[model samples]
Target: MPHSIKRIFTWIFWIFVLWAIFTSPNRAADLVLTIWEIILNGFNAIAVFFDRLLGG
Candidate 1:
């Protein structure tokens, strides 16, 4: 696999994961604020990964 192709796939995979997490059923009664906080943290991880890849 080429470097550019791998980068593209990585970006796509992270975007898909983020979308999936956001679109998942909201369990308000389970833990209202915690869910969003966790999701945000996951997004932050994704951002950090991409930042490192892109030489931020």
Candidate 2:
């Protein structure tokens, strides 16, 4: 049940993100930065998770 809820929310989240990207007037560098932001956010989440596990 919890897994399904997570999946639904994730889908909604990504839909909104994609909408934002398409609606924005952005250059190539802006697109690159958006990609970088996504990658960085993923890395930051991983780092935070590991940091909590290791520190505790």
Best by lDDT: 2
| Candidate 2 lDDT by residue in tens digits, 1-56 | 69999999999998977877777747645877999999999999999999999994
lDDT against the true structure, per candidate, is 0.82, 0.86
Q: Which runs of model 2 end up more than 4 angstroms from their true locations?
A: 1-26
Q: Judged by TM-score, which candidate is best? A: 2
Candidate 1 Cα errors over 4 Å, as ranges: 1-30
lDDT of 1 by residue, 1-56 (tens): 99999999999998976676677736433454788789999999999999999999
Indicate the residue-level lDDT of 14 in model 2.
88
Please state the error at residue 56 of candidate 1 in Å: 0.6
lDDT of 1: 0.82
Q: Each model's TM-score, in the order given?
A: 0.46, 0.47
Please report the TM-score between candidate 2 and the true structure: 0.47
